[model samples]
Target: MAQLERFAETRTPASRVDDVVARMRALGDDWPPRDGVAVFNRVYLSVTEEVARRIHLGAFPDAHAAITLDVRFAERYLRAVDAAADGHRPPACWRPLFQYRRHPGVRPLQFALAGINAHIGHDLALALVDSCRTLGCEPADLEDEFDRVGDVLVSLEERIREELMPGPDLLQIGDPLTHLAGAWSLERARDGAWASARTLWALRDLPGVAQEFGERLDGAVGLVGRILLTPLPD
Candidate 1:
């Protein structure tokens, strides 16, 4: 049976999400160093962003795909989403495309979202590299992810340009105003998810999480935290 089918027999999306979060916390607790903690944190955030992006893009038939079938592929999608979400210069790309009618008010938010998206992608790329080193998975394939994200962003930007500047070459859509509105709708969702991921990560503590993952390690998370947690023995 497919992986989703096997998972469906035992648990729902809510349960699966909980399990994943718990696993993240445990993994964090097990690995204590700064690099290890960073890796664990990025993996969790990357998976979350990937799931959100897939859902937004209709890559799946429905919401269930977010929690079910796509669970295993989150890391791959994370890389894809991050790559496309970064390297966008709205003024250069969107301005010409929109005939220089750039809305200054929304530009800041757009840039902010782009920045957040890049950070997410960068973290995921780093984590993938670390995982390849430590876990012996197939090579991280960071280039592929970067290319995928760049392609999507460019495509979407072209689509937006066409919508805004409907010359003889650029055909009309449902309605120029409505189309821009709708395009921004997807942008908002993507931006919101990026923001949420940042907030969640700030609130979480990775060392505690690692301990949960590697419960067997003596003093596990504490061992790493001790030096930081206490002053040198005088």
Candidate 2:
């Protein structure tokens, strides 16, 4: 339960953004199977920034394509998980970090997972940009486009929050724990010791609106600290 440091005192938005982009690029070309969340978080932020910048510069086609690609990659993960639920094994194309074998109906879960992560990534990026705006940076050159993206994310967050596990009226809707119980049972039956060891790590830790954000915010912020804000070279 440690608090994240406030980003309030960061350097000007433009400088901080350059720093973020540089640090992300410096992460190099290797991708870890276990780093799906980490990698996507960085890529989404970079894409969002690019879209914002391009739209500002009046590069409409470029901005449109960038956003399209971001949604495509993220949504594809959802599709793969869906396919896996229909008796198909996960596709080899997806990173191992996302491949689920023991669980059924995991496709929707994948969507929930990726959607939440992307939401957090965008949230942090916007916070940085908003901070920049407060610092008197020129009118983002495309404030309307930026706001359009923000509005889509806001709608998506609400939709995902209501559909994914232990929804708002959990008391009436029943616990996701009960539904995913099959997943737990499968894991235990396959390997109880290992499953027992890892179950607690999967529990959701917050409630209501904050819970929705909390679902992926920690992982996103962790990346910002670990990869995006690492000390830059002189």
Candidate 3:
């Protein structure tokens, strides 16, 4: 947390996106490839890099909104990482991943998906509100940016499944892991995130209600993450 805070303190607003990429890259280098968090980090790092590329090419209708949303979105996940590292409990949505990070029976795909579930289901809505506050715009104003980022995540989820899915011989429909993976949908998660963002935005005037809603959102997302991470047989 201190390290990231210091880095943020020195960074200019224009460099914030780059700062996020650098932090994710550093985390990747530090954690073993098979570590559960590392698995998610690799997946997220790839998505972030792709989004950065698209932003550079003017792919978004509103690049500034996209960048603000992207950076704010990434910060939520990074803060969870920092919290766990500092011996503090991460958000409910993140607890499952951190708890099962090194479990031997959890496949890389499950680790990856669980992390994605947490990030998209819980972190994204809050991040949207954060971005809106920072940009002085409503969630509706950032809808295009939100959808663009969600598109990147949806595409990446497909790739992650392909890369981490077991071979066909072992991935029978009867397999528990197959069933588990089938139950969660990145596209659905993305849609839910947008809805959640709107809901949070509406509740913004009631800070206590918003906070409670956010907490419940975190717990519900965490429950799904825990299920996604259910251990499978070797």
Candidate 4:
């Protein structure tokens, strides 16, 4: 416990993200490559690495603020990883994906999409608030950086679909994956995250209101995650 806490304390945002990328890479190398979670981990690892490299090159106007936002964003996922490791419950939005992580019937695309749903749907809004608090600014101030990060995620979604999508022989016009993918939109999630972040910032002074809003968001996202993780017939 002491060691973990100490390790957490010592890591700056960049180092923490680097560690996450490394851990994800190791998971990809060590775990079954076709395992759904492993597949998403690999996809997410690519996004993280890209984000970290951009951060190094001063891609953003405000590096500190960007780092704060990125770190807070990454920390939510890391916390889920830690909680699951320790046998503790993670956020509801994340529970479905974790529960279905190794379900053989769940496709790799489902896993990737489910994880994205959990992270963007629940964590992104809260992370904006975290960055706001840490940087002592409003959510609006972080919009540019948020959009940049979101663009990276959006591209990852494309890569994931192209790479993990079932072959034409296995896919049909009415396939469950097709229907599911058609319904879930990263653009919508990104827009919603922005709205939620603004709302959270507005409710920041009222902890009770903020908590309620966040809980509702969590529950809604969890429902979506559940649907995304639905095991399809092989």
- The runs of at least 3 residues in candidate 3 whose Cα sits more than 4 Å from the true structure, single-residue gaps closed, are 1-14
Model 1: residues with Cα > 4 Å off, grouped in runs: 1-8, 37-40, 46-61, 74-234
Considering only N, C-alpha and C atoms within 3 Å, which residue pairs clash in candidate 3? none
Candidate 1 vs candidate 2: the TM-score winner is 2
Once model 3 is optimally superposed onto the true structure by TM-score, how far is the C-alpha of residue 17 displaced, in angstroms? 1.2
Tens digits of per-residue lDDT for model 1, 1-234: 133234544896656545544444544465432332233244444445555565567654535533432343333333333333365332111112122112232222223222223333223333333333333333322233333433344345444434334255323465333333334333433343334333333334675754343232212212322221221111
TM-score of 4: 0.91
Q: Lowest summed-lDDT stretch of 10 residues in model 3? A: 1-10
Candidates sorted by lDDT, descending order? Answer: 3, 4, 2, 1
lDDT of each: 0.36, 0.36, 0.91, 0.82
What TM-score does each of the candidates earn?
0.26, 0.30, 0.96, 0.91
* Evaluation by TM-score, superior candidate among 1 and 3: 3
Report how far residue 95 has shifted in candidate 4, in Å: 0.5
Candidate 3 local lDDT, 57-174, one digit each (tens): 9899788789888888998999999989999999999999999999999999999999999999999999999989988989999988998999998877777888999877767779
How do the residues 82-127 of candidate 4 rate in per-residue lDDT, one tens digit apiece? 6877899999998888788889889988998888888898899999
Model 1 lDDT, full chain set: 0.36
Off by over 4 Å in 2: 1-12, 28-34, 55-146, 151-234
Shift in Å, residue 33, candidate 3? 1.2
Q: Which has the greatest lDDT?
A: 3
lDDT of 2 by residue, 89-168 (tens): 53333323244212243333333344233333333233323333344332244344434544444444444434533444
